[model samples]
Target: MQLPAKGTPPPARDASGLATLLRTAGATDTVLAATGGWLLSERRSSPATQDGYIRDVSWWLWWIQARGMDLTDVSFIEADTYAAAMRHAGLAPGTRRRRLSACSSWYAYLQRADAAVRNPFHRMDLPKRASKPSRYLTEAQLDDLVMHAVAHQSARTAAIVAVLKATACRISELTGVQLAALGHAGDHWILTLTAKGGRPHRVVIDDDVTGPLLDAYLAERGSAPGPLFATRTGARLQRSYVQELLQRLASSAGIPDPHTLTPHAIRHSVATALLRAGEPLDVVQALLGHADPRTTQAYLHVDQLERSPAHRAGRRLAAVVARRLHSRTGTREPRPADIAQAT
Candidate 1:
């Protein structure tokens, strides 16, 4: 439970130590492949990624089985119904799209063996993921949002907000934080996570912001070895739950289009905050655990949207129009308020 210092690389995780995310025990031999065993066994992806792929494919299979349907004969209507069902269940648009993709890959494998197997999801429409998430926050604004959660929400909500903003970790990484992975050393708090490829990644958070919020939540959550953020039954919090939590809080706080304040948006906020503070692009990429700096480079555009020089120049031009309008009306020169309103 005690780490030497913050930002220290965590011990590497053993591949065999990872639990199979999807159980194939209940599946009949004929349908075993449908549970995503081949995908997991093939090692085409990192263990963390395969975990996700299996979890998603398993859920799709489970839903179909519950409905007493077989994948071989599933129609587009049934696939469409499943997509609708995921939406109704509050799955984020991106999460739903990935889940569908994972399932489609499984079905694709099935087709290799027999060309007659139809992929209902092959033609399904999914929401496009934005090149970069639209939302970003300065450190101060992020703290204010955390304060809002503290005042208007639960300790757990505040902690969730703090973790996302401070670390910029992926949702999967956050869910992997166990009781043993949390520690404090010197002035910073250390959080160890199972990163992509099952590597143990560490994020160092300042005590000034995230430390107290996380501590408060854990005090209430108890000393269980399960996920740091868990359901009442002590299972890891699903990605959908975290997304819905942020959306709900944003709605209550009267943020315009609450759905835009997504969990991934919080990740964007961290990358933006770091870059604007004059952190090097490589440093930002390293902190965010991005394999490619180009991914981190995308965060730089967020400021243009927030403080567009073109927008400001256009506002100045619009103020000239206010003067024209006032001259036409034979009224006194436009006041500062009038110019502001025109802009």
Candidate 2:
């Protein structure tokens, strides 16, 4: 697909028009590859993940075609329909979310590059998520995986997973960690992250496995304060390499294949673990650097298995009072205590 150029007139107000905008924005093969390379140099993305984003955009382009709808002219109804169709196609909830997110981001890029006037995704309703986090590594599973990753011949590969899982960092955030971003906290070290949306936060390097691995790795690599991690060739690591490495680690650890295990699962696993430990919603929200707590709420469900004694007591008392009134009188009336309780 062709992205539009600067000051180019908006495309034909259809899918092709959207494609033109994308082309203009340099989301195309040659341009996107170059753009990804540039973003890598600037540390916007690891070279590997830029490739993933490129792949994601490629699939989105294909998916757009399969649906036979013009993204440039996508209406609210059409967008909604696309979401529904994606669900009906048996796509995993996470996959659907990513595809939608990809489209949403591309559209925004189009707008910024002046390829399009506005992003249709800005104000449209879409499908509700599955109401729960789908995949999370159990504590035991996480431990085993970390152990295996750390023991792997490649210390750098192991550290990648340890850091991503322990810190709940996006792969991008993990890759962006540099020596300059680290600071001492009285008695401990901290990893600073500047995430997407330009928000900055700190990930405490608690007694987590990745922290020590990172320290050792740093020392072996000369312990500089520049890039903390990099490829064996001394170039910064890529996102695709991380994904592939994660999958290899999972396979070796005898972990169940949830289709594709990724660094992203680290984010979900950490958030789920925090919520399960009864961490406050706000705390989890901040740890994940979410702009809203509601987003984190989707990862937690109030434990229904444990019945509250107070709630059961209230129900039992109401039943008893209802039976007593029927035995004492021909009709039932609101008891004063019940009224006060309701109030």
Candidate 3:
């Protein structure tokens, strides 16, 4: 079987394309098609996730076909060899893990259907990932960024930054926000977001900051029922546009590595700030709309370092040292000889 060109897009999400690919790879077309159908039918699977899984599987099939091996004949040895090939290709750890997971899931589905003898990935061990802390802007930096956006950019841009910082919503969720989804309950403003996996959550807006910006933006936008954030022509904003806007704002604000400033980084900044303020993990989890408490716990690790007694003591000691140096250089009592001469 001949593989697609190196840079060709993966097979489309359709029965005919899937069947053709499976047949070309010498895979069980009926079983693989059933698995694909099941994945598409999964209520929790987002479009991105479905597309990713399909791409991963397509790559796996190509790899097997190129080696003159059939997918149905794969074994634990082939799985291990695939892992080695991935490592040899210098794939990032996260990418390797996700790709392996996609293959594993397909094999598991086949096993359950009695179409395969064993799951090739059942006992395979992938490389362990290092725990890296999430990067976020400091409060001062955030303030500066927001101030710059407000002063130099449009009202809508400022409002977008404010909402992201305060609510920690994903960029997709933010773009999906409709004008009608915003409401006021007593002293608080609420935003209803349909997050990943189609989960709907309501979060309060920080009235002191985001509220005024939102009000100003809405006034500029006039009454609209479409996207909460839109262009002058009322077209919905794209995620890439928001990202570029943020990068520009960060650069204008003198933030280091401004290009790395993304909506998720702002979201992480919010979580870190909340955790440092001693907000409970469960509360922060709910606020971030994290499906798992463990995902929220990553922020706690960073908070622990920031709030550690040693870190606080070090800051205090540094301040004391600075004061002592200042006193010795400028505030010490005049030397006796110098004072006598002056007298």
Candidate 4:
């Protein structure tokens, strides 16, 4: 892609090939360079989020090409139609909203550079998102999944799953753990982590996990401040690797829809386990690194099986209280015989 020179007329619009439009949109020698720079400078979003925006804009370019519409001639109606099409394709509302925002940002950049006029997407309404509770695994199911992961995966992968479940950490946070984060007090090892948004948290390593983590680190001679999980080639492990590992393990364990087994699910399992153990909400919220208690509360649902005992106990207590109240109120037979004897 080649950027047009300053004050030059925009290249004649084309209907196919987004790479061409992206190139022509560049006003300098590097057509895509400016856009990339602007995206990287955004402080509000993470690197991953910025990358998604770039991908979304790239897709919008492809959509323009597939529909035989000139990118320069895109209008508000066209943007609305595209959004509708995305919804028709079964895209989630949140996803559609994000994609629209990405497109809007791209167009806004073009307007700033005088490469384009108005962003058609500025006035477009986004889809409304419905609230859905997070899904977490039961303790038995969590045990089964973790045990299967341990048996089928390498020590590193198994430890990754274990830490994710026990620590309630995001995948990025867990994979980004540093070796120096580990501190020991006698037989106990505590792993400290810098969580998302620069929050620090500490997770106590249970006896069961300590052996696996130490063994995995030792096997690799991991004594420095480097990535704990690495690929076969000794490079930092990528997110896709963890996902594939879960899929393979789930399939082997006869778990339906292996794709459903994700790192986030492991985090959810941690909250579920804590709630089942009758841990207080504040402690769970802190352990999960939730800035808002409400976010953590979403993961605090109790299973019917877990609540049955409490429900039964309440019923029993109510019956006993009712009997006591009846006796105290003289509802119990004040023997008619006692009344007759008194007369």
Top model number, lDDT: 3
- Deviation in angstroms for 139 in model 1? 4.6
Candidate 4 residue lDDT tens string, 1-343: 1222323332322212334556544334333554555565544245445545665676667567667765655789888888877777677798779879878877777677665557889978898876765556777776777788777766776777777777887887776677677787677777887665455678777877645765675576556557666655556677877877877787787776777777787788789789778899899988887888998877766575467788898566655655665666745533434433323
Considering only N, C-alpha and C atoms within 3 Å, which residue pairs clash in candidate 4?
none
TM-score of decoy 4: 0.64
Q: Residue 205 lDDT in model 3?
A: 88
lDDT of 2 by residue, 1-343 (tens): 2222323332223333434545644354543433333334433343344444544455445545556655455565655666676667666776667657755766666655555445666765545666553566766788888888777747776677677777788877777667688787787788888776445788777665667887777767775446667765566677777878877888888999934787787688788778888888898888888887888886664343235577888777777777666766655765857534433
TM-scores of the candidates are: 0.63, 0.56, 0.76, 0.64
TM-score-based ranking: 3, 4, 1, 2
lDDT of each: 0.71, 0.65, 0.78, 0.68
How many Å off is the CA of 29 in candidate 1? 9.2
> Highest TM-score among the candidates is held by which one?
3
Determine the backbone clash count of candidate 3. Answer: 0
Query: Candidate 1, residues 1-343: lDDT per residue as tens digits?
Result: 1112323321222222112322222333344444344455453345567656655665666566567775566788888888888777666788779878877777776666453258878878885774644765567766667778989998988998888887889988887678788877676678887766666677897778688888899899999788889889999888888889888877776566777777778888888888988999998887788878897898999676769788988677766866776766755656656665655
RMSD of 1: 10.6
On residues 216-265, what C-alpha lDDT tens digit does candidate 3 reach at each position? 99998988679899887888898899999999899988999998888888
Task: Report lDDT (Cα) of residue 175, candidate 1.
Answer: 74
